[model samples]
Structure formats: C-alpha cells, structure tokens
Target: MPLRKADVVDEALRFIDSEGLDQLTMRKLGAALNVQGGALYRHFPNKEALLDAMADKIVEGIGDPLPDTAWFDQVRILGNRLRTALLSRRDGARVMAGTFSPGANTVIGTDKAVQVLSRAGLPPAQAGWVSFALFYYVLGHAIEEQAQLGLPPDHDWRERTGRLAVEVSPQYAAALDSLSGTDPAERFDYGLNVFVEGLRRLQEKERAAQEHAAR
Candidate 1:
C-alpha cells in the first residue's frame, strides 16, 4: 500500500524521537520509509514543509476548550496545557518553536487562549498580544526543561554556577545561591503565575485610569 501523508508524519515523528531533529533529512526519511527521497516531495514540497507538518503534529492536541472557570484560571489552564503538549514528544518544544503552518489546530488553540484574555477585560489587540507572549514563554520554558532531560533530577544548576561566580565575586554567588533548591517545574509554575498576576494588575490599572479620565 502507498504511504499516506499522516503515515509519513507518524514515521517522521518516530524518526525524530529516535534520531533527533538535527539528523532528520528527506533522504534519511525516505530510506526509513523504503521509498525514494523524491517520494516525500509529493507529500511535502520540501524539508521545511515536512518540518511544519511535524510541528503541527506536535501541537495538534492543543485545541481543548477553555474550562468553566475564572479568567485567571482559564489562562493558567491554557498555559499549562500548551506546555504539556510541547513536552509530550522528544524535542517537541523545539519543533513547536520551529517552522509550522498556522492551520486549524494552531488557530483554534490560539483563539481559545485569546478568548480567555479577552474575557479578562483586555482589548482585542491586547488579548491577542498577551496570548502570543504566553505562548512564547511556555515554548521557551519547555525548551529549557527538555534540554535538561539527561541531567539527574537533583542536580542544582545554581550551585554549579555559584561556584564559578564565587571564584570571581561572592556577591554574584550569593545571588545565585538564593535560587539553589528550586526545581524547574516549580520555577515554570512560578513564572507563569507571575505573568498571570501581572496581567491582572494591568487590567485593574487600565480600568482605574479609564475611570479617572472619565471623572
């Protein structure tokens, strides 16, 4: 049977999982599929197209509906969900940050997030901007989290950096030491909460300024 496009995407993801993204090539994929390199071109015009498909596949499950909750909770849910999706596959976060088409899945996921922000009183443009900001923040955090996958769970990055800093200046070492026992997952949640809180504060400030201007 001839391979379908979805099959190609599935095999490509498997290839990426085992071989890593850096080693992905049309020729290699074709070899893995037992087809000529040109066969992939019929489905994807080029490597970038294949990468975009892979990225889309990585994030395809991000279109879940917003929960029945407060605006803050909605945003939190969306953010965490996106992070979870990106962390599902090997180097999935990097794939998401790379080439991708703004297809239905991407559009729906973004729309849900923007709707949450809009309900929180942000103007349409601001809500969209906030959604974009949150997406990038989650993507960057996931990338960092995945990059440390090979390290031991108890490894203290701050301690390693603190040692070098202490050799140069104790002040910097002390600062780094302050962050010494924080886990990456904890840090991710902390940063996300901070962002959500900041948005709340901004919404309040905007309303207050508008009231003041009206009076």
Candidate 2:
C-alpha cells in the first residue's frame, strides 16, 4: 500500500503519543509501521521534512479558520483549539513551535486571525503582530505542558523541574508555579484567557485612542 500523507502523520502521532518525543525516530516509526526503515525516506525526504509535515497537520487543526467571530472569541477559540491539538500528539507543541509553516492551512488561519483584528479596527501591521502573539501564547503553553505531563507518583522530577531556573525571573516564578501542578487542559484554558483578555484591553485602548484622535 502507498504511504499516504495522512497515514504517515497518523503513524508518527501514534508513536509520539505512546512513546513520547524522546523515543521517536524515523527508523522507529518505520519499524512500528512494519515497513522497511528506508521506505519512510521515500515519502518524507528527511526526518526534518516529516516533522514539518506533522507540524503542518497539527497546526492545520488549529481550528477551521473562523472569519465571522468576535476578536476575543477567535483568539480564545484558536488558543484552546491549538493547545488541544498539540497535547493530542507526543511533543506536538515542541515540534510545531520549533518549526514555522508557510504552508496553506497555517497561512490561511493566520490571515483569518489578522482579519478579525483588522475588523476590530487595528492597523494591518498591528493585526499581524497580534496574530503571531496569539500563536506564541498557544505554543508556549503547550510546550510547558509536554514537559510536566507525567510526573512520577513520587514527584521527584516535579520537585527538580519546579525548582526555580537560573534563567527564569523571580517575578515570573509565581506564574511558573501556576504552569505546573495541575491538569494541562485546565492550565491551557487559563493561560489562553489571560492572553485573550490582555488583547481585549489593548483593543479597547486602541479604539478609545482612535476615537479620541477623531474628536
């Protein structure tokens, strides 16, 4: 049977979910699929290429582009949707964050997101930046969840990983605590609302400024 793009990504996702990102490799994926190890090379060209395709598929699921929703509504929905998609696959968030997609689905979703901001009266450039901001928020939340998902019952890794990092700021430590010690799905929703609410404030300020300037 010919290896379909969907089949290839599905196999890769299944492997990721079951084995974790640490164990995934092209050779491992092929063996899992019961195909000659070299056969994957024919379809994917390289591991990086396969990862890109996987990222694309994952990102494409960021929600079927919503053009008619309110600004906060669109951002909130995309944030939640993207987080769920990444959590669905092993290291999906990490891989997608490491890669950028100029592919069709990603671009279309991005364009539609900006369109919502534009309709809310932001200039084109600001809207574009906000679109990226929303994606970054989603990616950041998802990647953090991946790292802390399966804490040992004794919580050894939890204590170690939760220790304040040298690079992480003290001011952010409280926020960091919120990032762990809870269900990722709930945390994802919380962080997503923060970003959307922040955007809502900015949008209101912008609207007020625009109105004031006209007065």
Cα-based TM-score, every candidate: 0.86, 0.81
Which segments of candidate 1 are over 4 A away from where they belong?
150-181
RMSD of 1: 2.8
Best by TM-score: 1
**Which 10 consecutive positions of candidate 2 have the poorest summed lDDT?**
152-161
lDDT (10s digit) by residue, model 2, range 1-215: 78776787889988888887778898899899888879888788888887787788777755475656577887777777777777777788887876644566677778777877788778999999988888888888777777766655555533565674545556665665665556677876776788778878987897899899999
Worst 10 residues of 1 by lDDT: 173-182
Evaluated against the true structure, the overall lDDT of model 2 is 0.77
